[model samples]
Structures are given as structure tokens and as C-alpha cells.
Target: MSYKTILVHLDTSVRAHPRLETALQLAKRFDAYLIGLYAVFEPNARAFNVMAGSAGYYEVQAAMRRERAGALERLFHAELTRAGVSGEWLAPGEPADRAVPHHARCADLVVAGQDDPGDPESYIGESFREHLIMSAGRPVLLMPYTGFFATVGQVPMIAWDGGREAARAVHDALPLLKAAGRASIVTVDTKADDAGPRIASADIAACIARHGVEVEMVSSVSDAQASAGDMLLSRASDLGADLVVMGGYGHTRLRELVLGGATRTFLESMTVPVLMSH
Candidate 1:
């Protein structure tokens, strides 16, 4: 159940050292190949490069880009050479949101930061995780802010939804769930929907049962006190959960997750690791 091909999709903004270190450790333990992915969104690039045209500017910018890629590869190679660290450099040309999931397609797992520390709020507002979970056909391991952590998938929580996203997350996270000692299916009740949770919970339980992993079902009210995302996280924290697995709700342009206020809050402030799928 150990992951062999691990892809850590990241932004140029994140300091590469810590993420590289974490990936190296995992690679050493699992003898896995780490794919370090960096995507340049066309819109973001255009917005960033707006200025009077100058040869020096283009040259310097191009150098910086190459340097970032080289630095990431060199750093990973150096650390991994001490053990079994086989990794490759991935620079996807599509928009960041699109490229990440494409990288995830061939990967057993995709990793990313939960929040961009520089912005602090809004969870990157990019739907990056959402895109991967919904379309990657794989599992995504979302590292919480400030990246340094021990092994993930230790104590996990499954966010139950009857949709394809939740199903894929559970399937992809099989390695984690099988390794976990304590895990549960946490769902919240929406004002207008009562049957969705029950159906989702049953489906998730059945899915896990197929893998011989028993998951407890924890249901809460997505109420006025907090959004659905916040409530589930709080419940997980109360249960001393270390990781959460949930189906992402979102599309490309219009963020589908906004409909669920809870997901937004959880994405922004979740302290523990979250394995999200769309």
C-alpha cells in the first residue's frame, strides 16, 4: 500500500527546502520517486510581467525561472542521494490549476500546502486542491501551513460524500487508511439536505469495508455556530484526528466549494493534514 510515485505540486512562492526535505524522507522510507511540480499560470505570469519591455528584464526573469527549477532538482538530488531518492523535475506549462491535476494523473499521490503563508487567508483562492481531487484520478495529500511534519496518513478522517470525488479519495488513500489505527467518516447536516449525508456515509463505509478498514461515522450539524468545514475540522480535532479525507466541491472558474461555507474555512485554517479529492 505504500506510494511509489509521489508528486508534490507546489508554487514558486513556497520555500523549496522544507518541502524537498519532507519528500525526500518519504522517498527514502518508501523507496519512491518524487516528482516536484511547478506550474506557471498564464494569467499570473502576464499580470506579474507587466512592465516596459526590456531585454535585461526578460533575461533576468528567464534566469530566475531556470534557477528555481535547477535549485529544486539539485536540492532534492543531494538529499535523496543519501538514500533511495529517485526524483524528476516537472514544470507543467498549463495554468497552475490545470497543470497540477495533470501531474496528479500519473502519480499515486499529490501533495500541496494548505495555505499560502504569504497571504495567510483564503487558502490560495486558486481551487488548486479542488481541481486535483476532482480530476486527478488519484489521491492528494495536502500539507498544512508551514510544511514540516512527520509521516502523514497516520491518523486519518474520511469525509463522506456519495460522489465520485469522495470515492476516488478513499480509493487512493487506501494505503493510508489501511495503515491507520483510528479513522472516521465525518459528515455535516445541511439545512435542506438530510438524505445526502446518510447515503454518503453508507457508501463510504461500504467502500472502506471492501478494503477491510473499519471507519466510524461521525455526523454533525452544519449550523450557525460555524460553517460545515469548520465544524467537521473541530470535530476531528476534538477526536484528536491527524488527517482528514474529503471530496472537494468546485469547478474551474466558479468555485463550487463556495456553496459549502464549511469547506472554505477548513481549507483556510485546518491545522492537520487533509487529503482532498474533487
Candidate 2:
């Protein structure tokens, strides 16, 4: 019902500070224990040795990585101290794509950064966010790569489609909705075939209201030129929403994961923080 433990992924990117700040704020708000997991991409030393014909380069890279990790650990601890929140730092020497999801499962919520194509330092791999959302088995809160969000969950908009994934997302975000005191459930490009007559936005609104959250239902019909993701973002901006809660839609095909069109759009162009669950 409440977030008791929050796991945040930290990397050697400029945006790491903002991500940590967001996690710290949530930790303080929920009175939860915070875990800072330091995971970054490390090139294969063996491959480097084969190319350079020497181990010296590998040693140098390892040493530099250690130094950066140590600095990040110190920063994380200091910030936690200043925030008066209890937390611990972890550096599991493993691929972030695997390690993050392994650690994230134990926490109630996971905080991660959106992939920045321009920042190679933070790149874990392709479809990292989609993989995390699918494998974490918990809600993931992703911070935008280009924004400084001092406040989250103040005014939230829920992207609803009445599917299983959307249902899971809405419930996973219940704590934030209750804390925010108000939320808007926006259904974009609603079609009778998509959401059956048995399920309606009003019904979900009533359910959320029972939890003491003031819920508003907003329905919009999107034009052929506009995508559902675009409609959702425009509505959020118009409502001055700081957070968006929605389902991360994706599926595996031929050992590759393909995110839904709307999900892909949000991951690539989110202006505000987004909380997604699969």
C-alpha cells in the first residue's frame, strides 16, 4: 500500500544527480529506506587486451571506474545524510541491464533515468527501459533526461486504456495518487473495440475516489495525425501535471523486445517524470 523501500539506479552521467534528488525526495516523503545501486557499462577487458596487446590499458580503465564509483558512493551517502533519510550504496560488478532488474525486484519501487542518445556514458544497451519495466516486477519511475523536476506527484495524469497492463499500472501508482490528493484519468483515442463496454474510465475513477483521491475523468479523441502518446503529453501539459502514470506496453519477438508505439514515444520524448508498470 505504501512504498517501504525505494531502489534507485545511479550511473556516471551528468543526470545522475537529478535522478538521485528525485529518489531522495520520494524516500523522505514515503519514509522509506533508499538503496543506491551503482551500475554502469564496462567494456570487456579481454577484448581490449586482444586489441592493444597489453593489460596496462585494462588496469587503467578499471582504476578509473573504481574512482568514479567511489566518488558516487560518497555523494550518495552525503545526500542521504543531508536529507535525513536512511540508505545504503551498492556496486554490483555486473552488467546494469541484468543487475538493476535483479536488485529492483526486492524494492517496492525502482527509480531510473531515461535513455539519452547523446550521452554515451549512461548507455547500458538498447531498449534498457523497456527491459527493466518488463523484468523488474515492480513499478519503475523514470526521470526525464533533460528536465529538473523539483516536484513529482503533485498533479498526476493516468493514461488509461482498460487493458491488463494499464490496470496494473494504475494500482501500482495508488500510493502516489493518494498522496497527490488529486489525479486525472485521461483516455485517449478511445475505441469500443479497445476497451470493452464492461470497463469504463468512470468506473476506475470511482474506485480511485474510494481511496480518498479526487479523480477526474477526461476523454479525448485524437486525430489520425496525432498519436495517443502525443495526446496524453498535451493533456498533461495543459493540466500542469508533474507526473504521469501508465503501462509500459511491450512484447518479445524473436528474442527482441518491441515497445508499443505510445510507450516508445513517451520513453523518447517525455517532458515530465513517468511511472510505468508492465
Candidate 3:
């Protein structure tokens, strides 16, 4: 909503030029404090990074890591300087980049990149933007890897299921959606499903309508054999939806997101942008 402090989750992995640019624009618009945090994850886990081998090799490798980390900050800060974002950079020691959640606790909002467009093979690998939403303890706004969004929440798609997760996303998205000219809520095959999903969809639509939003609700079913993500994507495409706002449909058990059907499809194959809240 009217964010005063916005913490953008920066990646030192691939050059996040687009993400950095978008963050600066958002920071200027909200007139908020912009924190450009470069998370220094473990060296062992980085495929492109070299490991500390012998005593002789350790110094060289560590120095290279520090240089790369510094380079990333300089490039990012240059954009902030150009855009006048009022930003600060941080590279934590112990948890490295993993400490982003803790740092986000003090901010009103968190912004994270969606995927790396340069590396087709490793883009959005095990490292997903969804983790930011699930673990951030706050609503996460996922900035797309390729788009040029100066201000988010402009044209958004709302995933309506009448569930707690969907409700939270809607409440979290109100700041943006209320500012938009139009917002759409999507429900899959409300006509085919039993009373449960249908009722849930209706309830979600009704709840948001009370918010005084100029909204439209659409219910469409997949081809029956389509993947869950595919169905949602297809519907969004058909609606010409620019962004999708929904719950972070995650697994309740071990892996966080093992439910592994439509959710995984949506995460992987989405052509349109998504705004997920857990």
C-alpha cells in the first residue's frame, strides 16, 4: 500500500540490470527507502563460483568472490545514483544472502527478481522467487526478469479460490489493485466442479467486490487433461492478463512446494507475470 521502506532482493548470480532498473523506478515513485541487498550465498553451492581448495588456492578464490560481490554492488548502485533511489547496499557475512528474510522484517515491502533470462539452462533453477514469498514473512512483489515495469500493481490478475492464501494475496494486493483501473479474478471450471470450488470462487469474488474494485470474474475449465499451470496460463492468456495475483500454492510438507501440479506449471511456464503471496 503506501510503502515507506522497500527492500529489493538482489542477486549477484546473473547481472540483474533489469531488476535493478525496475527497483529504482519503484523506489522513486513510492518515495521510499530502497535497500539493495546482495545475498552472498555459500560458495560451495554456486556452480559458477570456485571453491576454496588448498591454502594457496583459498586466497585466490575468496578474493575473486569478494570482487564479484563488489562488482555487483557497484553496478547496482550506479543505477540507483542515476535514478536517485536513495539506496544502500549490504553483503551480510554469516547467512550471506539467506539473511534477506530477517532484513525484510523491518521493511514495509519486499521486491525480488523472477528469473534469469540469460542462462536458459539454470534460469529459476532450485533458486526460485517463490521462496522469497514463502519465507519473507511479508508480502513479496516478484519483479519479472524481462519486463519494464516502472510501477507495479498496474494491470494485475487475481487468483480467486476463497481460501486463506488467496484472501491474503488479495488483501496484500489491495494497495496496488485499488490503484489500478481494472482487475480480474480467475476461477477454473467453476461450472464443472462440485459445490465446493464453485462456492469458494464466488465467495472470493464477493469479498473483493466489497472492496469497491471495478472488477470482473471469469470461470473457465481446462481441457480436462491439461496441467494445472497450463490451464491457469491459458485462461490468463485468453483474458489478455498482464499479471496474476494469487496465493503461493505450496506444499504443506517437506519440500515447501511439493503439491506439484498446477502450481509447478504456473511457476515454470508462465508467460504472463505473477504476484504470489503466501
Best-fitting candidate, measured by TM-score? 2
Q: How well does candidate 3 score on lDDT at residue 131?
A: 60
Could you say which candidate leads in lDDT?
A: 2
Tell me the TM-score of model 2.
0.95
lDDT of 2 by residue, 1-278 (tens): 99999999999888998999999999999999999999998877778867755688778867887888889999999999999999999988899999999999999999999998889867977678889999999999999999778899999999987777788988999999999999999885545465454356888889899999998888763768888888888888998999999989888999999888779989999999999999
In Å, residue 167's CA in model 1 sits off its true spot by 3.1
Q: Which consecutive 10 residues in model 1 have the weakest lDDT in total?
A: 119-128
C-alpha lDDT of all candidate models, in order: 0.67, 0.89, 0.66
Question: Candidate 1 on 233-262: residue-level lDDT in tens?
Answer: 778778777788876665445545342454
Candidate 1 matches the true fold with a TM-score of 0.78
lDDT by residue for model 3 (3-88), tens:
67888766555536666666676677778889987764444444443445455554576677688778878887788788877878
Candidate 2 Cα misplacement greater than 4 A, ranges: 53-59, 190-198
Candidate 3 ranges beyond 4 A from true positions? 45-61, 115-130, 146-151, 189-199, 209-212, 252-257
Clashing pairs in 1: 133-277, 133-278, 134-278, 228-262, 229-262
